[model samples]
Target chain A: MTATKPYHHGELRPALVAAANAIIRESGIEKLSMRRLADQVGVSRTAPYHHFKDKNALLCAIAEMGFEEQNQMTREILDDPEDNNNEAVFARWVRAYIRFAHENPETYDLMFGREIWKGGTPTPSLQAISKTSFRLWVDLVAKMQQRGVLPGSHSALRTAQASWAALHGMARLLIDGIYVQREDLEEIAETVVDLLTRTTPDSH
Target chain B: MTATKPYHHGELRPALVAAANAIIRESGIEKLSMRRLADQVGVSRTAPYHHFKDKNALLCAIAEMGFEEQNQMTREILDDPEDNNNEAVFARWVRAYIRFAHENPETYDLMFGREIWKGGTPTPSLQAISKTSFRLWVDLVAKMQQRGVLPGSHSALRTAQASWAALHGMARLLIDGIYVQREDLEEIAETVVDLLTRTTPDSH
Candidate 1:
């Protein structure tokens, strides 16, 4: 039960995940391997294998953490009773979403990048959390639509997908060093909010 | 000038670019190299170096091709006076944009992915053409707004950035093996068209 136990039986999993994150942050994800991670965590080489079968599993765990953080962030926005204004909450969510992606570029990349979704297998737990994160987003979209924060012209699923794609696009552009610049993040997020919230000219 | 000559005097450059594309398409971008490209094009290993300083140069060439093709497609769509309607042309552009990404996933990834834009130095030609491609897109967006195809509320640059981000996001989610499914491309594209074109509910 000592707080300083680096390789305690129950503490090893989180310690490994934390260390893996540090290693990835210091270097890139490519630099974080199970063998190196075990050494960094001050554990036996096989100790990490007990937790993560391989690098992919460890990546999935990190990605799962990202989804949980995303889900928690979304939940806070949706559940905040103090801010009943859908428009304000939606704006907050938009900024927060892009901010998370910008701040956690590596984790965001793993959460949505080809490494897990295409190049490697995502653990069932990772998939489950990822799906839940999306479901929460869709639910939030539906709520926004009902309150006229978003257009009701499309279904919740479609709107969520489209809007999420917009956010994801902005995030990826910033993260991947594409067209968007980090300084432009706030502008892009605001524009996205306005774009999604504004009624179509045809509807008017 | 003989087309049959695989390594004709001045044809080596185009030959190398073509062979590089084939190698990347068959194996993956990671499998491509200037030396291998020269071998594949039936030229001396040093031949590719004469044209492309390194693999990055070759990749820039391929990405340059993608931007050229994109610009050409946009030009064709915008110049088609036979279909003067903005809505129809805008929809076509969206479909074509996603189609280009889907059909040329490798090139699209290289063009927009971290490999060129982040990890590798983009040649001046690549930067120029990429900027041109985006400028063309922004110009098209402005035209759509003028014709009421897009919302007139946001300036062309903002609207262009936002809409392009949406389209890019959709392409990436699909390409990166994220939540999007290839089968759902049409549905998502249509929904995006709807999302962007429909007047914001508040406007009413």
Candidate 2:
């Protein structure tokens, strides 16, 4: 009898996600579908279903990677001894955040856009990763407060949320092309850093 | 011969835009189509096409209305003599911006989302209204600087972009559901106002 060949693709999960990312980048998330993605990846239509329960699940996985990528970049910025000064560190971090969004508009949209969150479609895994990522930000805010880089009068959670909203807002503006001129990024980032780090009388 | 009934819908343009807004609110912009909208509006399929060249044109029209509504609200807030103090005026404006976005998520998204701007699809009419709206914000920022509400160290344009970015960011967060916890809106708005208006050494 002839030996039967294994039907499994080498790394179907990662392969599907990578293909989805490419599709989303080339077109947009709205164009992505399980059958289309499977076809693009040279797999059976049902094969993707086994890995991701549905399209939302696949999007969540893609967004999960975005969070991980952002978190790693954040860690690298924080750990860099070359820019230990509070202001420089904070500025670099803000720039990095915006740069990430600008470079990966599709992924960034999936990570924070209305598609997942507003639609109430985030998977349990997506929620878990996103919560952890947010906690990391809160912890960093507390550290900045301790170092006098951020105002200490407000709670760390509050400070993190407010400051993050600023950075996130700018990122969205740039990514969405609402801000128009790309040259304004540096000035805008500087202004944001200054506003966020200005020592208040109450904090002093 | 009996007189032919008028085929023209008296207010086809406004009626089509209104139906489009309702459809977008209920099922998102992607689900909105010219054929479906015409059917919902009790008009011939080609009727909407006459008013709007395509779906993008319809979206631009809706977003144009959003800009008009927001600009009117902003004008009222600024013109109101009740809140004369710099901090109060600034805070009220910020809160009003967030409230508008929160109340009209889909409209806000269309006005500022990547769907229109990133696709390079904003109509000339939409562009004109949006430019006017942004210019109004810049003018307000300059006025705030003159009044010592915002730091004079930075250029009015830079400060306006940055401050507006923060408010815009916060609004996007709230509208997208990424911020979760709707109860924190008030506190977050207060924190943002404080950050934006804190006395700078140069200003002092």
TM-score of each: 0.87, 0.91
- Go through the candidates in order and give each one's DockQ: 0.54, 0.65
DockQ of 2: 0.65
Q: Show the lowest summed lDDT stretch of 10 residues, model 1 chain A.
A: A195-204
Residues B1-204, candidate 1: write the lDDT tens digits.
656864355787887888788887887776877667777878777877778787788899899998999899999998897985656899999999999998888889888986777568999999988888889999999998877778788788888988999999999877876666778777988988887886543433
Q: Kindly list the per-residue Cα lDDT of model 2 for residues B1-204, writing each as its tens digit.
A: 637636777888988888889998888876788989889888888888887787888898899999999999888876777765766777778888988888888999899987788764999999899989988898888888888888887888888888888888788778876755788977988888877887786654
What is the TM-score of candidate 1? 0.87
Candidate 2 docks at the CAPRI level of medium
Q: What is the per-residue lDDT of model 1 for residues A1-204, given as tens digits with 9 covering 90 to 100?
A: 667864466788899999988987777666777889889978888888887788889899999999999999999998997975656988888889988987888888889976788668999999889989999999999998887778888788888888899999898878876665678768877877877787544444
Question: In candidate 2, what are the lDDT values of residues A12-90, reduced to their tens digit?
Answer: 9999999999999898877888889999988888899888887788899999999999999878876676765766777
| C-alpha lDDT (0 to 100) for residue A46 of candidate 1 | 82
Clashing pairs in 2: A169-B169
* Top TM-score prediction, candidate number: 2
